[model samples]
Target chain A: MTIPNEISGSINNIRPMSQSANRLMNIVADPEYDCQDIIDVVAMDAVLTAKLLRMVNSVAFGLRVPIDTVARAVPYLGERMIVGVSLGLCASHLYNKPLTGYESEEGALWTHCLRAAIAAREIARYANDKTILDVTYTGGVMHDIGKSVISIYLEGSPRKIVQGADSGKFTDYIEGERQILGTDHCEVGAAVAAHWRLPASLTAVVRHHHEPGNSPQEHRALAYAVHLGEFVAMMGGTGTGADTLMYRIDENYKDYISISAKELELVVFNTGQEYEKIVSAMFDGQETAF
Target chain B: MKTILLGVGDLGVTNKPGEELQAQSLGAGVAVIVADSRTGCIGMDHIALPDSTVSLRRAEEKPGYFADTGIAALLEAMKVFGSNISEGGMIVKLVGGANVMDPNSTFNIGRRNVQAVKEVLWKYGLGPVAEDVGGRVNRTVTVESITGKIRISAPGREAWEL
Candidate 1:
């Protein structure tokens, strides 16, 4: 779906993805990229280097020997995680917003996105989908990027949309957004992903995370992983606002991801623990209190 | 007056006068509030899942994350504030546990969480004196330590006393 001209204009005005983040994305996208390529890209950017080292040494990682150098930290965090965290740090301002349209306070979306990222990583790890493990984390982080852009347009409409969904007037929140706004977060998020020149896999996850079955076959597993990751975040009470858990779960996720009941529970449990630790670590010196 | 915010998988109790214990933005997670009429102690537990067996070690680290262990820990916390465990001495109230996800999904953790909380409470011969549970709506619950009045609020709705 083509985004409205006004929204598309706003997407264009969004701060471009950082050069280092774009470079990291490029290296990770290549099947034969070596570890040194990632290390060089990170080291070239001092701020990204510091963030990477701090995260690796954060309590969430619990590394007894602190990772002080970008070279070691890059491998420890993996190429996908480095890419995800870099993109997140570069766009932190977008994620850190009130989302007044959704009646969510400042930092709510950021917390939800971070929670989803952690949950997505756990889900992929538990399902033994190593190929998508770290990439799923990046997918989860960017899945809701459209919300930041569309929130202003949604002000005063959240109540009506939620009521419509609950009363069966709409199939779900995405439909509610479509019928009400002529667009939804998924379409808008996909546009933002494209505008940022993100990898196709990440863009696919952003575009179809709400309906993973509709994603391209190649990226469906990662999309499903992120879809369940967001669900776990909501279930753990890290939802952004009124739209939390309002999206339909594509039951076909079972076809793409194999996780038993016990494992799903463990995913939920571990996600919450990791989310808090990471949030605390990320905001240690910041003014926001998680 | 001090207000203590409760996060997911955590609980808080207070005997101090005019204090408030609150759990905000509970999706499928459940929050239980217990207020002692005599001791004037109030406490709340924010539960994330139905069972602790999902991860016993993590549950041991943060028991408030699970219904079974959370209820037990909540009661224990209340006891520290001198709240009585006997019937009629404590007034229990429940909130949250909404199936915020697709209603048709087989894994309705909200329903499971409520059921688990009830079973654990039943073992203690206790039941909720009031409750606002089970819906697609997200809820925020606050308990006043001095008055033992529980307030339930949701998006676009007026706050109501439970």
Candidate 2:
């Protein structure tokens, strides 16, 4: 389907990811990047450096002594958390908005994103190989970026959308979106990722987190990891709204990740604990930031 | 009126008139709200998993994390508020248990949770008098202690009494 003019304009309205964040994302995407590369990039951006320090010192990371330097914070938070925090800071406007179109309250999407990020990282722990945990985390954080663009269009018609998606012969909510709005979040999220020049792997995750089977073969495993991660997020009760759990879990995830039922429980448990702390660290003192 | 909020794996009970208990954003988890018709006391539990065997240690720390322990803890909490299930004055309402679009996947924890909650209630010869459970929607459940009324709301749906 062709992009609707209005939707295109909405997509254009999304703020670009900050330069430091984009640079960090690029370095993290490459398999050969070292901790010093991340530290060098983060240190160049004073605001992000301060935020990174604040985040690591927060109770979320649970470091006993307060480490005041970027070099130390870099390895402790690792690739996943640094990228996660950078992306979060970059997209605050998109993440913090009240998705009233989805009938979700303020900060709902942000909470969902944070939980999904944690869940994705946790799910990647069981991967057959050394998965790029940071990539999976970034995928989780940016998976729903399209929702912010499409939410305004969905306002006041949630029942119609739900009934059209659920009662009709539609496969899932995304189909309902395509039929009703001429575009869906996945398409729009892909557009947003492309607009922001996100790494291709992260872009694939944005587009295929709901339907990992359809993603390109190379990026499919990361997509599946994110897919199950978002499921774990919703299962633990941290969905955006209205359309929570409305997406289908591509069962093919079993092919890519090997999490037992007991392991799944631990994923939910660990995600919940980490989610709470991240939420606290991000919002504890800065009520007005959101 | 004081309002109490229940997060995942938490339960609460109140006898004070005008007190309200609420649980929000219950995706696959289930919330069981019990009220006494005569005394107007209310109890609620927001349970995450179907069985406590998932992690006995975590469940031990947070009994309300599972249907079995959560319901048991909820009932025990109600007794302190002068409400008893055997007296027949109690009313139960169930909410949440929304599944991801897949019904066949073992990850359909929502279905399992609803079934587990029902089975636990069955053991007490009890069941929800009214329910708004199962779907692809997150729910926020609220109960008014004084009125003995339960209200269920979702993203798009209007608030309705259970």
Candidate 3:
């Protein structure tokens, strides 16, 4: 089925940023913003604050002590994690919805996204490139934002997409999306990142994660990290299914990342443990605004 | 002829003269053959975690159950067809073990599966002569008994022999 160009174009333009996310972004970009200012903003939204605290305390952070409040988490998690948390909080709502054309269920896409972000952070750390941690986290979380738009456009036709996905027609499903919705999720996600004025590295990560060869050199590492992370997520069966397993890993990336097969195994083992804790905590909290 | 097929995990693939089986993602299905001069053994394993290639969640009811499936499949193949193969002339090779699941979850069936295979092989005194296993990518593996050559297939990547 084909979508009209105008409708598809509008679908590409869709961005799911909530009002709270916009405010959080402002706080992150504001030069004079203090911890208290961020805390105050979080406090105003009890659900986001609780989610933030739960995430900070989750095993993903490798925190030794339990964090009771957002105020307490700030100093320990620092500004970068705080930003990641805020972004997580803001984007959680969007992730609650399902992705059309992908077999992921409600929360599956978000879970995969969050895992990729965390994996990206760990990979960056493993590669001794800590500076990109925040960007990687943000990029990983938002990498599939385009899927959100695709989901909306294909709202009533999820079964068709799932059938296509099961039959190894994922590329065809995306092509059908292009025909009916005007654009695919990758381009739409990239547009959302652009609208948010995210870093170029992040935009690239969102845009080309599905096909890493298309990424520019500067963003290639970031793209690879997400690609690897997402693959791990899919294999683990926490996010998508095995439908896309046929994709290749770039051998060239091995040179830059220094990740051997053994190291990759370790990453998966470690990340799986962390994902369990984070998901448990995310669901444990009384409030669920984020 | 009898053949023994070995399947390696991500780490196992890197340490070898064995062919690398590139599956689409981890947890994707893979076929490996181990044989000698006359007989062939076929085995299938699915990755249960996500890494570079594919992603899959552990079966929620029994988190690490799939690990045993890989070993059982191979052993069952050997038991069922053990008597029909050629005498002392046999070759062994390996493939499969993609990390395609949530990296940060509590399940680690992929690593466990790799270890289980190794342990089972050691018990049976059937070591791999050549192998390609592990990584995030899925692999399709085939072994030729006559030449003892193994072929692997991966998407967007070239096929190679080990």
Best by TM-score: 2
Tens-digit lDDT string for candidate 2 (A1-290): 66699999988887788998899888877766687888888888888889888877877677899988888887667767777878777788898888888888888887888899899989998877555566778788889989988999988766777777767667677887787789888889999999999889989989888889989988888898889998899878788787877777777677888877667767887888778777777775777333
lDDT of 3 at A158: 44
Per-residue alpha-carbon lDDT of model 1 for B1-162, expressed as tens digits?
A: 678999888899988887898898888889988888887888889998889888888689989989989999999888777776874688888899887444345447788889899999999989998889887677888888788878888764557888
Clashing pairs in 2: none
Among these predictions, the greatest lDDT belongs to 2
Worst 10 residues of 3 chain A by lDDT: A240-249
In angstroms, how far off is B115's CA in candidate 1? 1.0
* CAPRI tier for the interface of model 2: medium
- Clash pairs (backbone) in predicted model 1: none
lDDT of 2 at A120: 91
- The chain B TM-scores of all candidates, as shown, are 0.93, 0.94, 0.52
Kindly report the interface RMSD of candidate 1, rounded to 1 decimal: 2.6
For residues B1-111, write the lDDT of model 3, one tens digit per residue: 232333223111111223332323334323334454444333333334333222234333322223434444444445464522235444555565553333442223444
For residues A59-137, write the lDDT of model 1, one tens digit per residue.
7677889888887876567666677668777887898878998888888888888889888888887543557865777
lDDT of residue A88 for candidate 2: 79
Question: For model 2 chain A, where is the 10-residue window of minimal lDDT?
Answer: A281-290
Off by over 4 Å in 2: A59-64, A74-78, A288-290, B86-88, B101-104
Calculate each model's fnat, 2 decimals. 0.39, 0.66, 0.21
lDDT (Cα, tens digit) per residue for candidate 3, span A1-290: 34446546765555556566666655643335566876777777777777677667765567787888778877766555566556766766567665544544566567777777677666665544434544666667777776766665665554554345446665434555565566667777777777767657778988887767689976777787777666666555455322334344454444445565556656665666666666665665443425
